[model samples]
Target chain A: MITCDMAVSIDGYVAGPNQRADAPFGDGVGDSLHQWMFEAAEENAAEIAAITDAGAFVMGRNMFGPGRGEWDLDWTGWWGPEPPYHAPVFVLTHHERSPVQMEGGTTFHFVTGGIEEAVTRARAAAGERDVSIAGGAATVNQALAAGLVDELRLHVAPVLLGQGERLFDGVGRTELTPAGVRQTALVTHLRYTLSRTAG
Target chain B: MITCDMAVSIDGYVAGPNQRADAPFGDGVGDSLHQWMFEAAEENAAEIAAITDAGAFVMGRNMFGPGRGEWDLDWTGWWGPEPPYHAPVFVLTHHERSPVQMEGGTTFHFVTGGIEEAVTRARAAAGERDVSIAGGAATVNQALAAGLVDELRLHVAPVLLGQGERLFDGVGRTELTPAGVRQTALVTHLRYTLSRTAG
Candidate 1:
């Protein structure tokens, strides 16, 4: 299964302004959007577990870190020495870099080609397991536009960020049927199955 | 109580392009987005009843008809002699005209003052009963931005209209807590209470 999961604000923004190492989700925003994962960890254990259950993960360079242009040699990632993904992760980038082996069975392999190449590599690494597309809006949009995603899980937070990077900005029209819906005080989890018949 | 009700596509559009006298929802769009009201009328009787139960309704001039600039004195809305609104209906417009009394106690009162004035008149007409803001996206957004609406009921249709007027285009960051949620195959009805404390 090719699944893509993302946490979006009610206004459909994934991240706010001035993304950096300290403020990954932007300045004043903090982690309030993702309080469901932290504050209600025990209650949302299944959701948290589901997010990291993929055999292989594909993500954009922006999601990996704030580094742009040439790769920052020192910057491993935001998750310190040990990353959460216990499987091979493919990072789509313009500049090529050697695979960075981190603690916990995670390895970040840089893909210079494109989203297709990253997905191809991730699918190969995944083998029998599912290949997950971890996102930063643009990456998810690309994957969705390419029709590479089979399952879409959206963790919709109640908060509204008036302006930011919208998940479906240039994604155009795509058909999805609701497979499941679970709601909590913090966020609403909506699972959708991509209809193969739809363009 | 003040309430705003609108049926929006998955892409957040309330209506499609070339909204005219013949095609209110636009050409080729048909009534597919509101199939629940027609095909499943018996199944959604309560929802249909709730929509027309408003004592007074406030709608934009665009929603009233396709006529622009000067009023076509002959045109008295698309609903023949008797409209669905059994009570007084206030139409917001820059060009004022005498109130047109229709059959079945329905009257189209043109309010030139503004959205606030329209709501005020609707509230007055409603007495103790609820006033509904029947919309065309822009009107709803204006009401939401002005913080005049107390409750927002969204009928989210599964259909995707890629380009059209979005309900939340320039409404800014208004907060809403989910009051209730009901789902059917045709639409997902989301009721929300407008948070007075939120901006």
Candidate 2:
């Protein structure tokens, strides 16, 4: 299943001004909000640790890095020498960058035809495992609207920013089934199983 | 529909350490999230403003804010002046906090029991709209495993933190259907319609 792993402030914000691109995230105020999962050095830590057949990830150019901001040009690579999301990561970008090959089995492919083609390639590469619509809100939104995602997980943090990048908006309404919930000292992890109620 | 509204660094980190108790919410890295949503300021912005009659909101104590960290105190009044989530918010806490009323229509209900109780109450309150499970990670994980959510919305930002909280961990096997996706200037909003697949 496709799971969207993200964080938000208790006040319902996603990130702060693009100016402080270095701040942990948009919440400008929170520190513990998105730290739980990324701290896990293990391969399973970055993801749910569930093994699937095999597929690639479809992502927006920004999801991988800032596509249009001033920082867009300076960013070398967000994930370090080896990022954990080790799969074929398809990035939707306008600027052309050579494919990036990582250590743990991740390759960044830049695609320009929006998300449909990205999913097609991801699924084909996945063979049977299932593709991941890796994000940047635009990418996930693209995947969802195209009816390409399968599951989504949100690790919501407790904090109120009063404002920031919101995860909801633009995308049409869709229904989901709550599969499970896990609480830790810092954040609450919500896992959702998606179902289509109508066309 | 459930939107996992959150923001993280380009490296996938949500916040910093300590989760400082004395610090104001929007004071640090976690505050970067929520820029887009607040700007939208839909009528329901602070009031669950959807006007769609979304029922109870599932929340973990940390998500509720206030008495987070190792102490696990029964601190309810997390939102300060007027808490955001106006619906019946279920706070998963080991300690008990009396339901407190806020300026808007928001009320905080503490739940020592698991997430099921929170979901049940939220569902009941949602008369027609739907139950929105606000997070903290643990709470969401429980809900996903139980299969109660109907939709998943993920807003992916442009930053990536090399470390921080993660949305999914040990989420086992779950399946879903992609409802739709939307591309925006800030975040990519992806909505996944849910379905039942496995435990």
Candidate 3:
């Protein structure tokens, strides 16, 4: 299944303002958005495991690093040398770069073609396993607009960012059926099955 | 206690495009948003009853009618001589008009001052009973921004409008705890208790 998982604020913002080199989430706002992942690790163990369990992952350039234009060779990613995805990870970007092989079988393949190309490559790499769309909002919106996603899981945080990058800013209209719903004090896990035939 | 209730699309839009003289919800979009009220009345009886059971109600001018600038003296409201609001209903408007008394003890008191004034008048008329903030999106956002609403009940429709009047457009940051949640095939009823102390 082509699944996309994201943690969003009540207002549908995936990340807060001023996304830069030092402050990725801006004003330490992103930290509060993912408190459910760490603070209630035991309770959300299944969800945490579901996020990185895919055989291959596709993410936008912004998710890889804070740099723009030229590729910053020094900055690998937010995750250390080993990273989390123990499989092939495709990074969608305008600028092309050679694949970076990290420790623990994770290789970052920069795809300049577009979202479709990245997903195609991820699917090829994934084989029988699912191609997970690890997002930063824009990439997910692109995927949804293209009707590439099969399942969409949203970790809805109770907090509101007020202003930032919204998940469904330019997504237009997409049909989804509520497959399942689970709630915690910090976040509500809503699972949606995307209608391939409907828009 | 003060309460705010609204039926919104999955994308948070309360109303759709091209709101005109004939189509109040903009091109028959409002019908799908409130299918639970009509189609499944028996199941949602409590929710339907809760909406108009208030002693007094407050609404924006937009909810009263589609007229802008000056009030069409003849235009009482979309509702006939006898409106759903059986009690005193305060309408927030810039163009002040004399209170229009309707059948079944319903009176439309046009409050020119602001949301606070409308609430105040509604509160006075309500006596010990709760005051309801009947919405058209803007009014509810204003009430939420001003920290006037004590409880928020959202009738979340499964459909997606894509673009329209959003409920949390410019309400800034507000804290709310999920008080109650109920779901039907048509809609999901989410009740939130506004934390006036937190923002």
TM-score of each: 0.91, 0.46, 0.92
Poorest 10 consecutive residues of model 1 chain A by lDDT? A190-199
Comparing 1 and 2 by TM-score, which wins? 1
Show pairs that collide, candidate 1.
none
True contacts kept of 1: 0.18
Query: Which has the greatest DockQ?
Result: 3
User: Considering TM-score, which of the candidate structures 1 and 3 is the better prediction for this target?
Assistant: 3
The weakest ten consecutive residues by lDDT in model 2 chain A span A44-53
- Which residue window of length 10 is worst by lDDT in model 3 chain A? A190-199
lDDT of 2: 0.55
The DockQ of predicted model 3 stands at 0.48
> Candidate 1: where are CA atoms >4 Å away?
A197-199, B27-32, B197-199
True contacts kept of each: 0.18, 0.00, 0.28
lDDT of 1 by residue, A46-161 (tens): 98899989999999999999968999899888888899998999999999899999999999999999998899999899999999999988898888878888888888776666
Q: Rank the candidates by TM-score, best first.
A: 3, 1, 2
The candidate that achieves the highest lDDT relative to the unseen native structure: 3
